[model samples]
Target: MPSTVTSHHRDIETDRHARTRITVTTTADATAVTVTGDLDLATSPRLRDRLDDELKLRPRALIIDLDAVGFCSSGGLSVLLEAVTNAHARGIPCAIIATQRAIIRPVKLLQLDRVLPLHSDRAEAETWLALVARLR
Candidate 1:
């Protein structure tokens, strides 16, 4: 019999100068993390912390939504790379949602897009997660 995991949701907002918000929703198969506002030197730590907290939950997959992000700096990219590395090390799949050019362009330039599974929207990412869950 397949075990069922309960769903959980958390919304964490930071009061830092960059004003980033993180919302994490976890289900049996995956964890969806939505990030909004600027992602720069002043705010990357907040995101890093949130990712760490979610990673501790040990979800089968992690989907990071960056559609609402207004800006992303090198610091933010570093945080993202770290998250991907951490997830992979734990045998968890990780995907990214980044439609806007602001987020996509930089990622492509840095070749991080190749390292991360990039999706255009939440639904696409969720579909991938579903497939991964089914395979597992």
Candidate 2:
């Protein structure tokens, strides 16, 4: 079955005092969250909660696109890792797109790219997600 996009940009999550933009697009089989701006301690929790909530719905797959993220801190990395872990625990496929240096530098420095299902291309990630979801 072809997945349907129930909602795109359900809401643009951003606090007046914050510096991040989180756009969550939910589909029947997948949820794609595109985040821009800095991802630090203050902003990562909101994202974590959002991902956790999405996982609770038990989507077939989850995609986090962080290509536009300008800066990512340890707290942000923790959030991403935790999200992927949680999704896996629930048997949900999760993909993370981190093509920019902001996310790539730290993940590689920590050697986490091996553990986190890192993908540089969204199309490739989506294709993989579909294949994995189908085989499940």
Candidate 3:
């Protein structure tokens, strides 16, 4: 199987705010993880778990789509940083698709743009993922 996976994203409104729902479906040959919702101190752990799980799959590349994220906090930044570092260490590339300012603002504030590659569209992410997969 090719290094490709299907990811799903959804949004659920809560009393305080809305949570994004992410579902990742991948075959034994690929890795996929989807995250939806506000990634803050309270929710960052969930993302960290997902990233850790994906790393075990040893995917050629990991695509993290943030189009459905409503808000991002420092804790979220920490998880993202860890995921990026882990991916780099394992010779796996990670791409973040962020088209919304809510998601991009925190990343920019944390200077993550300088550390991780960001894609404005899925096509570019797919292309980058393929390239990274070949590197590994």
lDDT of each: 0.84, 0.86, 0.72
What TM-score does candidate 3 get on C-alpha atoms?
0.78
Question: Candidate 2: lDDT over CA atoms?
Answer: 0.86
lDDT of 2 by residue, 11-115 (tens): 758756667888888777678888888898889998898888888988778999999999898999999999999999999899999899999999999999887
Task: Assess every candidate by TM-score.
Answer: 0.87, 0.90, 0.78
Residue 108 lDDT, candidate 2, scale 0-100: 92
Give the residue spans of candidate 3 off by over 4 A. Answer: 1-18, 27-30
- Residue 53, candidate 3: how far off, in angstroms? 1.1
Candidate 1 residue-pair clash tally: 0
Compose the digit string of candidate 1's lDDT tens values, residues 1-136: 1228777888878555667788888777788888888888888888899898889989888888999999999998999999999998887888899987878998888888788788998778878767766776
Give the candidates in order of lDDT, highest first: 2, 1, 3
- Ranking according to TM-score, highest score first: 2, 1, 3
Looking at model 2, residue 115 earns an lDDT score of: 77
Model 3: lDDT equals 0.72
Clashes of each: 0, 0, 2
